[model samples]
Target: MSGVQTPSIDFDAFIFDLDGTLLDTADDLGGALNRVLADANVAPVAEHIYRPAASNGANALLEAGFGDKWPELEQLALRQQLLDYYAEDIAVHSKCFTGIEQLLIALEQNNIKWGIMTNKPGFLTEPLVQAIPSLSNAQAVVSGDTLSVAKPSPDPLLHTAEILEVDPSRCLYIGDAERDIQAAKAANMYSATALWGYIPSVDAALGWQADFNWHSPIDGFNHI
Candidate 1:
C-alpha cells in the first residue's frame, strides 16, 4: 500500500489494537489453543491459520480449532482451557511487530501519547502488556471489560480517548481488523489499518475506509 493518500488529516494521539496491530501475539495465542487441542486429542492447527483468529481472542480460536469437535457448552469449557493455557505462557512466543519498537520510540520523542484499545479481556491483555517492557508506559489501556461494550460498538475506543484526555477527533485508531476501523468511525476518530498484521485471506482492509493503510509499523509513523 502507499499508506494514507491524504496527509492532511492529523491527530494528536494514537490508539492501537493489541493482538494483530501493536503486538504479534499470534504464536503465543495459537500455541495456547494447540495445548487445548492436544488435551482433547485434536490435532493442532498451523500457526499461520490461527493468526487471523487471534484478533477475536479465545472465542474465535476455540471455534476455529474445535470446528465441530464439540458443542457450545464444550466449546466454552475448551475456551477457558485455552485461556488457562495462554495465561501460563502469555509472552513465551509473543513480541512486538517488526519496527514497532522504533515507531513507538519516535512517537514518544514527538511527545505524542499512545495507548492500547483491545477487545481482549483484562486478565490476558494486562499480563501481555506487562510482559513487554517497551509497552509499560502506555498512556492508557482499555480492555474488553473496561467499558460496557467493546469494539464495533464505540464504547471502548471512546473510553480510551477519555483516559488519554484527547478529543476523539484528534486521535488516530489503528488496527488489523475491520471491527477496529468500524469502532473508530463510530467514535469520530481517524482510523488506519495495519496491513503488516494478521489478516485473514478472505478479509481485506482496503475497503475498511481507513485514513491510511500502512504495510508496516514504521511506515505508519511517517503519517503520524
Candidate 2:
C-alpha cells in the first residue's frame, strides 16, 4: 500500500520590515542626507557609507555623518531637514524590489493578510505606504514611533499582530536585518531572512539565525 504525503502548512498572516525589506528607499534617503549635510555647510558622505545604516533611522544617519563636530542642537536641526526633504521625495528613487509586487499579489490572492512593522517614523512610514499603490491596502502598519519602544524590542511586531487580530505564531515576518529577526523571535513568530536586501558586510546566517533565507522575493514564496 502507498502512503499519503503530508501537505505543507500555510501561514495565516505576514509581517514585514519597511526600509530595506519591502521598499528600496536607500537612494532617496541618501539624497535627503546629502542635502541636509550640504545645507549645514558640511561635506556629504558617500552613498555606500549611508546605505547599510539606512534602516537605523534618520538619527543614525545624522550621527554617522556629523557626530564628531556638530553639537546636539545642530544635529537635531539637520535631522529635521533630512526628514522634511525625504517626505517630499520619498518615491524619487525608492521602489519595491523586483518580484516583490508579484509576491505580494500572490499573498493577497491566497488570502494571506500582511502588514508592516518598521522602525521608520510614522510620519514618513504612513505616507510612503499610502504612496505605494500595491501597499495601500495593508492590513495594519506599526511604525517606530507608534509605541514607546520599537523593533529588536518585540513591541512593534507584537503590536502589529494584535492589531491584525492574528497570533504571533501564525505570522511570518520577513526582514533584511538582525534586529528584524530579533523582534520576530522575541514575539515568538516565524521569520525569514531576506538575502536580497541590504546585508552590508555582515552575514545573515551568523547574525540573525533566521528560520529561512531567500535570495529574492519570488524565492520567498516557495518557503511561505
Candidate 3:
C-alpha cells in the first residue's frame, strides 16, 4: 500500500463555550439557586443537585430544584434574585479549570485570536466573562441573546468568527454539549468535545460528531 499522508490545516482562531469549557462555574450557580431558595423560605437545594442541569440555565435549575412549586408569579423575582446573588459571588468558587490559564496564555503568546460563543444568556454570560481576568481581553464574546438564534444554529459561532475577523473553517470550537458541536459543524469550523465539561449521562457523541475530543484544556493545546 502507498504511504498515507494526513492533510494539515492551520487554525487561526479559537471559540470556547463559557460555562463548562473554560470555567468550573457550577458552585457559583448552585450557590445562587440555594440563596434564592432560602430567601423564599424553601429548603436549600444541594449544590450537587444542579450540576447536571447547570448548563441549561435558570429555568432548568428552578424546575429541577423546585419542580411545581416554582410559582410563575415569582419567576421573575426568583430569576432576579439568582442573578443578583450570582453577580456578587460570580467568581468566588468559580475558577479556570486545570491548565486553562496556561492554555490561554499560550494562545495569547502565539497571537491566536480566541473568543467565547455561549448559549448562556447575556446577563450572566457577559458579567461572568468580564470577571475572568484571563478572558478580559477576549477578541469577541457571542452570547445567546447576541443573536436571534443560539447554539445548534450556526449563527452565534459564525457571528463570533466574523467579529474576530477570522475564517470559520480556520477556527477551532471547543464545547461540552451536543449543541456546541452542532453550532461549530454548521459554521464549518473544526469542533472538539471537552470531556472535562458538564456533559450529562444522556448526552451521546453520536449526535455531535466532533472532529476531535480532548480530556482537558491542556490536551487541546497541541491540537490547536
Candidate 4:
C-alpha cells in the first residue's frame, strides 16, 4: 500500500486464486482429510496442523494427516477417497475470507473485471463455486485441469487471461503460494501475495518477490 497507489497502476482485469485467497476452505478440506484418516484408523489432525496445507492441495493435507505413515498408505486411493469426501459437502463450512465479499463487491461496482484461476480441479471447483453464491460472480473460472498443466507452469494463468479476453500484461494475479507468484511472473502479469492465505510458518512470503504483498483482503481493497 505504501509504494504503489491505485492511481499508479491501472490493471485491466484482476485474476484471483481460489482456496486461501478467496475462501477459507480449510475446514471443509480438513474435514475430508479427517475422513481419510478415520478410514485408516488414524486419529484426526487438528485444524492448525492442516490449515496451512489447504492451499497446497489435497496431497499436502494427506501428508499432514498421514505423516510418517504416508508411505504405508495407498496414496492414490486415499487421495481419491479424500476428494470424494470433500466433493460430498464442499461448502459446508466454507465461506469467503474476511473482507473478500466487500472487496469483490467494490470491484464489481467499479466495473473492474475479475475472475478465478485455481489449482483445484474442475470436478471439485465447479460444484464448490455453485454451492457458494457469491463465487458465481466470477466472469471466468479456470480450474487445474482446465489446461494440460497447472501452476508454476504459467499455462493455466495464461489460459485464464485468454478466457477473460485480457492481455496478460494488463492483468493482476493474486494468490498465496510461491508457485502462484512464479506462475504470474512467468505469464508476464503483475502479482500479489495474499498474506492472509494458508502460508506455512516456514515459508517466507517476502522472498517470493511479488509486485504487492497484501496482509488481508481489507488491505488489498484499500490499495485498489
The residue pairs found clashing in candidate 3 are none
lDDT of 4: 0.87
Backbone clashes in model 2: 0
Candidate 2 lDDT trough over 10 residues, lowest sum: 1-10
Q: What is the TM-score of each predicted model, taking all chains together?
A: 0.93, 0.89, 0.87, 0.94
Over the stretch 110-155, how does candidate 3's per-residue lDDT look in tens digits?
8898999898888778878878898887899989999998988999
What's the lDDT for candidate 3? 0.81
Give me the runs in candidate 1 sitting further than 4 Å from their true place.
1-4, 70-73
- After TM-score superposition, what is the CA distance of residue 87 in candidate 1 from its true location, in Å? 0.4
Ordered by lDDT, highest first, the candidates read: 4, 1, 2, 3
What is candidate 4's lDDT per residue for 29-74, written digit by digit as tens? 9999999888889999999999989999888999999999898878
Say which candidate scores most in lDDT: 4
Q: Give the TM-score of candidate 4.
A: 0.94
Backbone clashes per model, in order?
A: 0, 0, 0, 0
Candidate 2: where is the Cα deviation over 4 Å? 1-9, 70-73, 202-205
